[model samples]
Target: MPRYRKRKQATQRKNLIGSLLIFAVLGLVAFLAFFRYELQNKQLAYDTETLCPSNITSPKYVALVFDKSDAYNKIQQQFLRRFFDDFKANLLPGTRISIYVIDAHNNKEIAPDFVVCVPRTGDDANALYENPKLIRQRWHERFEQPLDLAINGFMQPAQADFSPIMEVFQTISLSAFPLGSETVPKQIILISDMLQHTPEWSHYRGQMDFSKLQKTLYYQRINTDLQQAEVNILYVRREGMEKLQNKRHAFFWSDFIQSIGGRVTLIEKIDG
Candidate 1:
């Protein structure tokens, strides 16, 4: 009877050891599962769009502003407000917008918010341009897309005619539709004052060799499609920028716009 009891005791010890080992394994698996879940959530939260961070240390937001309001000698200031709000909305959410407003005629610098952030408030330095570097860095993971347009000279007949507007754009896209560089432009927006006139269509700036510009545009265009990148032209004059201004902006901009996959909207008259 004592021998039988010893055998039963040994069996119970073995059973207890097996049960404890099984529980330990189960506990370890649960902890590992929970830890993995937490890590995945952390990574996911950082990799997507969110509200704009008031500070630039965060990695996903970018803000760009071209304040043409220096020319707003008259129109209601609220128009400028609408223009900015519309611009902010057009950007992907959680984007930070840095603003730069240049005096329409004198080239005087107007610091909307970057008053203390820059060395001197003028075109002499890109401090105005530098303020947005943090945000631009966030786009480095994507391909670089170059965008060029006549930001200053789309009005004169010779200068405005067939502006090598696509040169910069192609420079960034030849290898990939989107070029991935920490500071390269992933998109392009042209904000223009819509008053354009071709004084005399006789001689052309074609006398000017934009081979460099044309080359920059052509090669990238070979690899990229005008359809893929989002191009927005914010015209200070919505009066008929993409429609009526075509006679000067391009040979037939209405058609070019269709071919290129873009839409034009008036950015409120700043020159009135």
Candidate 2:
């Protein structure tokens, strides 16, 4: 009876040990799985071509058109710099920004000088899981620097006989925000003197008559579909053109933009 009791006691100890081992293994596996999931959640994934976040299904589109037909004064430059700073700050992650420069000499094809999507920055990072410094550094290198360089290069003054503001707007509409596609949110920031001068139509030709403008062949050629885009006109004041650039001029532009399916949200004048 004593030998049998000793064997039973030994068998009970082995079973206890086996159960503990199994529980420990399962706990370790659960811990590993949880750690891997946390790491994945903290990490950011971006597309190679668009630089947009992989998780983003719909991203906002911002198009900036800098009309460099005339030189900007010191005051105007300072305002523009500050405006750009704010613009950069307000941009959300995964938003695509395209910067286009319209020069004095009109090119047959208009393309964006800089195009990039805002990447995940330190603000979007988790401190416990990821290094914010590295993420911010990558954002600055990949997005901020190149954009600043492109903008600075285009900010230089250029003199031309004609400022094709209308043609450039049409081109931007067709290329950036095409018709029948309202899936993505669109915004256009136009920094210009608001002087529409082209061979077909010229704001310099006395007063702007919207009725007459509609009758011209130039008006007929406008197949621009802004697709309900939000237009922000940063009107740069031109020297000795007070008669041309007045309340009437502003109204004409607002009316024109509205006529083309665009909503003129802001028509702020950049005072020089």
Candidate 3:
């Protein structure tokens, strides 16, 4: 009887030890899971659609100014497609992209075709916690589709009697990148023939001159503060207009952009 009692007590001790070990392992796992959840929530605590904080304001701005004063040919269109693809790929998740069109007839009116902040995609999601497939689907339905539609509509041929590129710039600087706002990275993708034609001043009349433009009242009227925005000129080259769209013409525009507190990053000529 004594021996049997001793064996029973030993078995009970063993069971208690096993239970304690199991509880300890579970406690460790719970701690790790809670830590991971806290860290992820802090970093990715953003709205799914805007990919921005609760304020819904983006930290970066990208403005695309399309000059539809002249129609783009098939080859130029192809080039534009490739350029847009590259631009989309490099964009950060929360960047705001606004599309503006320089009207063909009405140089005074500058209207935005599309404006939206990029959403977080599948690639930006964590597979361990979030469903990437659902995020991607939502992004495509809400963000990508509308952007594609707006761009396609602008790609169609539209000819204008005048191209008021300077006025459009001034308006964009005032409306899009308003003064006193928090300084953020700003970029302008200008797709045009780099030709400035209006009732006041026309580049087609004679040789391109930067000094002559600075002396005019129109220059003062169009004086814009671009807020140190980076300008990428997608210069459209027209057939049989070499003299107007040559290297000197490009330099003239470059000087003008610099005077307005904008840095010219690229001046790529898009030709058929």
Candidate 4:
């Protein structure tokens, strides 16, 4: 009986030891998982650009200046929608987007009429969120809606007959962006026919002369500095204009804009 009791006691001790070992292994695994989670969070927090990067990146200011005189066709709609889709993806913390109209009466001023401004704010709290769906939802709710509304509003036909693109450019470069931050990226997206048809210079009447513009008071009046802003002119092709004329118009504007401080980056023809 004494020998049997001893064997039973030894068996009980081995069972207790095995249970302890299993618990220890489980605890170690839990600790390792927690550590990995914390490390990933830290990395994401450091790397994420929450509205403003921890590093030095200039604020981006985008102006979508549209010529109200141009026909708002389906092709223009598609291109603009595509642009907005890309814009949604690339939007960072310190980005501002504005829509303007190049109309006939600019209050007798050399400036485009302001339509709306969509500015992006940073979400520091959600920067390290594990789920990307929530992040996109936030962006769509805040930034995307306002931009879409502005575009829709601009798509409506205006009563203006003339398109003063030069004045619009000058206005945007001079007054649209904040005055103090010249180091930031200033982008002007022009949606027009690339044909300047103002009271001063009419492209249809063959009175479009760049040399005379320099000599006139209008040039001096609209000679506001762009501070090396980039211009992307998305020329909307009209129904009657020849292919050669369109090409010439694009080239003329490219050279004309570059003559000023603006760097004309794109001169694409949008067929409607």
Best by TM-score: 2
Q: What shift in Å separates residue 127 of candidate 4 from its native position after superposition? A: 7.2
Measured on C-alpha atoms, candidate 1 has an lDDT of 0.36
Q: 1-272 in candidate 2: lDDT tens per residue? A: 99999999999999999999999999999988988899986556877755766655536878899988898888988898889888988888878787777776666665666678887778867676688899899889988887887777777888888888877767777666544448788999999998888877788987487777877777878747788889999999888999999988988888888888789999998868
Off by over 4 Å in 1: 1-32, 44-168, 171-188, 194-224, 238-251, 260-272
TM-score of 2: 0.83
**Candidate 3: clashing pairs of residues:** none
Q: 103-154 in candidate 1: lDDT tens per residue?
A: 2322233222221111111222234224345444433222111101211222
Q: What is candidate 2's local distance difference test score? A: 0.81
Q: Evaluate model 1: give its TM-score.
A: 0.35
Show where candidate 4 strays beyond 4 Å: 1-58, 108-135
What alpha-carbon RMSD in Å does predicted model 1 have with respect to the real structure? Answer: 13.6
Residue 66 accuracy (lDDT) in model 3: 86
Clashing pairs in 4: 51-93
TM-score for each candidate, following the candidate numbering:
0.35, 0.83, 0.81, 0.69
User: lDDT of each structure?
Assistant: 0.36, 0.81, 0.80, 0.69
lDDT of 3 by residue, 177-233 (tens): 745544889999998887888888888986478889899898898998988899999
